[model samples]
Target: MKTWLTRCLLGGLLVTSPALAQDDDAPYAYPEDEPARDEQQEAEEDAYERRRRQVDETDDFRRVSEEEGEEGDFKELAGVDDPNIGFAVELIGGALLLDSSEGNFAKTVAGLGLRATWEYGRTFNLEPLRENLWADLRWTYGSYSDGTDFIRGDTGVHYFTVAPAYELKLGKTSLGIFGQLGGGIGYQTTSITIDAAETKVNGIKPVFQYGVGLRGRPRLSNKLSLSFRVEAMGFRRGYLNDIFLGGSIGTAF
Candidate 1:
């Protein structure tokens, strides 16, 4: 019985010795070098924080870029306008003499005059006058017959005239009444044949004219317009002592 008790006591002591050894090593089982899980968790959190900061910075840059683009577009739209348009016209016509200091000359005397005109001007207010004022220059040619009692009988006189004038607007459509005043220099040439005798005479004179007339215009295209004007004027000179009636139709460009 004593020996068996002693063996039992020895086995108990062995078991207790092993339990004491395990308790002493428990504090050193988890070392600072073996903290792999904690290190991994901290590293993951740091990476996540870095990624979040990058996302925030990218969004801030995107917003700033959008604002700058809008500002650039507004600055490109602020300077200068367009231009105004204009044109000129030329009218030509036949002329008739209306007065005579020489008697019974209408049935016996023959006369004709040609007129050339140039007009140019532009709109002032554009709403009030598309074409405001115009300047006109004219050339006239005329021929007439003489009576039997004159020194050079069975003969005639020819006249040439150059006139400069101006016109003001009374209305639109080129079909309206207008008043004009102008003066110019003239030249006269005479030819006579009596009893098989021929003679020639020439002279220079100054001329004055006043007229009121109507104009009618028809449009052909955007760059071209056709116009007509009827005008009358008085002429007094060594060659002609009469009033003249005339009409003209021409193109404008």
Candidate 2:
């Protein structure tokens, strides 16, 4: 009986020893906090996403503002509050068709003139004839050379006028067709060359002017413009009529 009990005890000891060795040789496992780490990483990603979205939104707003600015949503963007009030200088070169009543001296003459104008835009509505009513104060100087054989002569006229004008705008653009009527007083001087001798006539006269013109600002720039005009001018004491066809390149401010 003692020998059988010893063998049984030895077999039990051997089985338990193998199980203990297997447990000791197994790899060590630390407590996992993966859920906490995952929550922290997810929170950081959400914050970064929110910040990126805000930046994108700000950029979008800025882009929209710039677009509005370009479309002329702001009145002061170009420092022009009144589009109609401006100043211009014109160079006029053309032929002056003098009245035939003065005989051969009244023939078509080559002429040049300079004009400085201050324009007041849209003072009233003359809806019957035009869309808008405007006015201009203009100073003008002109010189004419007669080509007729009766006498080689030159004439100079200087004047100032207040012109009430009408403009018909083309759609919403900066182009318009305009007409003006003006009257003023001026001095006239004429020099006639005959037999190598020069004789001059000087006098003061009442002047009247009427014109039709096409005016435009290129690329919508209000500070500059070009104009083409045809004018019929008369002097009470000098000539019956002088017709002028010319164009002007000018700047406005």
Candidate 3:
């Protein structure tokens, strides 16, 4: 977020008393030590004022300027630019293993995930671990099967979630082991069918998600760039708690 600073200039300095300014030629007029400013000087001062008005500061105290070099840096960091910081339109698929929670008996669900990232490696320009830092935005949806249809007739454990994640690789290689930590809102649903009647219950609750795996990105062309990760993850919320073993395919720009 941006916080604009209001400029409060002293108008009295520019708008002198009419009696003094108009009576300059009269007796006991004010003595001017500095020469009258030329048109060029006035224009320069006006330009300076305009430039001052163009500066805006961000929440992290980063200064944003009208200059393209600096402006682009800030915009990309804010994830406002079209070609975000990293991967875009990445499609991921994985498997979720449901836990032994009461009132709901479901396990081994197939899930799909979408991940987009705003990497900070360029914005911050730090060395060593720079390549591993990014702002992760992910959404996951799944179609899972209910473990046993005999006890609860037919049961379904399904969910869709959105989370902000943090990921970092262990080493600086195209194929490196990485770990991710994320938490966000998950709208989980539990469906049960007894005889011929079907009933579902769902709620929006906080999710606990984490994953670790090996990923590879060989640095291909922007349009053809591809990356993948195979991970063992744990997903949990108010409705269900389970571990996930999955892999993902991502395209980077």
- Ordered list by lDDT, greatest first: 2, 3, 1
lDDT of candidate 1 over 52-91, digit per residue (tens) = 9999999986665455344474221111121223333444
| lDDT measured at residue 115 in model 1 versus the true structure, 0 to 100 | 48
Tell me how candidate 1 scores on lDDT.
Answer: 0.56
Each prediction's Cα lDDT score? 0.56, 0.63, 0.61
- The candidate that wins on TM-score is 3
Candidate number of the best lDDT? 2
What tens digits encode model 3's per-residue C-alpha lDDT throughout 1-253? 1232222234554566655355545555356754587999899999998777665334224543323464454232333332424555567787767776665555666777777765555465444434566545777776554435543533344444443334555455667676767777766667776655677776677787776777666667544456777878777786567777888887766
- Taking the tens digit of each residue's C-alpha lDDT, what string does model 2 give over 1-253? 9999999999988888443354666557667833355888899999999999999999986675466455676322222144534566667666666555546555565656666665443232222333245565655566767656666988776666667777788888767787888887777789998867889999887778788877765533544455444454443335466566556655644
Q: Which residue runs does candidate 2 get wrong by more than 4 Å? A: 1-85, 103-106, 122-131, 139-153, 193-197, 220-239
Q: What does candidate 1 score on TM? A: 0.51
- Alpha carbon deviation, residue 8, candidate 2 (Å): 42
Judging by lDDT, tell me the better candidate of 1 and 3. Answer: 3
Error of 1 at 64 (Å): 34
Model 3: residues >4 Å from true position, as ranges? 1-85, 102-106, 145-172, 222-224, 238-240
